[model samples]
Target: MCGIVGLFIKNPELESELGRHVSAMLLEMSERGPDSAGAAVYRNEVDSGRIKLTLFSSQAQPDWSAFDRQLRDFDAQSTVKPHLNHAVVETSKSLQQMQTWLQSHAEVRINSSGKKIEIYKEKGSPASFIDSFKVADYTGTHALGHTRMATESAVTTEHSHPFSTGDDLCLVHNGSLSNHNRLRENLRSRGISFQTDNDSEVAAGYLNWRLQEGDGLDDALHHAVEDLDGFYTFAIGTREGFAVLRDPIGCKPAIIAETDDWAAMSSEYRAIAQLPGAAKAKIWEPEPAKIYSWQRQ
Candidate 1:
């Protein structure tokens, strides 16, 4: 089974150090899925009244280096230097403006952005990739991640998990979504855009578009369970909170662990046990079709 993992820390103060812990936990579970890996880590900076956006190539291009320099000149308060094919930019403008500008380039995929959050993910095992930014260096009250063993599509960065359906709303799925072709067409008819043939990205885009139209996270997730045909477990991360759901049949395996300090869930208990103090933490499995949600404190 593809490995899926998530963490939601109650105390914003504790969010700072979680990246190292969570990363360590994820690495330990990496063996479960060696094909490709990705993560969406949330960073909440006291609403300094800024919009932080993450930009990356939809596919690597020859102009990336030039574009990187151009982006840095765009009035960002600060910028994270490009790592691999992605960069994080903290700006004062609305995400729409940033998207509009990036769209002009045609080579960039505004990846994912929104209120105090910016995330980038790539295909390939984290062990082999040198992430420009480390989670330990970033501060967020919540985050979610995944590693994949491709079952339907080729291994490419765009096909990686934690597909950003929208600014602040992203999803990492661990199972094949049957009937996704038709579902993709259905969603496209409604104006939702997709970047890859990957079903996981399609699921994320569909749910994000639904939420944009006013569907609650829970409702969108329930709709996914009923409408999307397949066995899947998904971790959805949003600016305010995150939620995980298992398909009605629960064909995939997942386990959860909790502590007074943090909450973590993954496809295996070994993943959760990888976290610090987890040996003494309370751990259990989320019942199939059940939902779990937590917001920053």
Candidate 2:
């Protein structure tokens, strides 16, 4: 089991408080999942000509300057902002080009990449992850947070949730998939590579593949409902907005709440209760197999 939380600030004036709100929401779900935690944040700082990638180094003390230099050769305008073991990189290179360039450099692991996305995660309790990452200090439009219990995989940081496979796209799952092995093979044959054995990564890859094939967010999720065999609830994050989905059976828990200032979804309503004005927010459990989304116009 796991816990997932998402908050999208509807009022731009409250964007600066997004991280604080999400941190509170995450802390509320700490009991549901105590193994690890992660968050994907979207900001408007990135321009269309460039992409932001979150790179993680396994080294005790990564040479961020040298890492920046390596990227400089690929995209001279590249900039790396280091935070502990992970660094957020902004580069002018095309997605495919930067991806190919990173292929030869296996020392660095790419988390999430998008024009407006940065992902941070680690193996620890929610409170620990938040404190070490300075999660509460971040300001963004929207964010997705996950606390993983790790029933199926090793409790390493690499096995954390909020996995990403495409630019500005990420997913956090609260349930399991039965056909991931077969699906993973099929997706690999179709050229979608994966870095882990986690079933959730395959789900993220499946959605990314559909999006790459021209499917919109809703369509991609609907396709996921049909093509993927799973009992799961997913919160997906993108540059445009965020989306929530549940399998037809609805075996897992999920609640969505929206107020004038923000919209949020979590494994339980208690998480949503942490938001401001949540007392008057429209609150309800997500229906089975339904796609619920909120985007900034």
Lowest summed lDDT over 10 consecutive residues: which window, candidate 2?
43-52
Off by over 4 Å in 2: none
Q: How accurate is candidate 1 locally (lDDT)?
A: 0.76
What lDDT, from 0 to 1, does candidate 2 have? 0.91
User: All candidates' TM-scores?
Assistant: 0.90, 0.97
Pairs of residues clashing in candidate 1: none
For model 1, the superposed segments whose C-alpha errors exceed 4 Å read 44-49, 58-80, 130-133
Worst 10 residues of 1 by lDDT: 127-136
Per-residue CA lDDT of model 1 for 8-82, tens digit only, reads 887556877767766766686678777777778776552656776667765554455576567667754545546
- Give the top-scoring candidate (TM-score): 2
Query: Which digits, one per residue and each the tens of the lDDT, describe model 2 over residues 1-297?
Result: 899999999999999999899999999999989999999999866876888889887776888998888778877898999998899998888777877898877778899888888999999899999999999988989999999988767887788988995888899999999999999999999999888888998999999899889998889999999998978999999887899999999999999999889999999999998999999999999999999999989
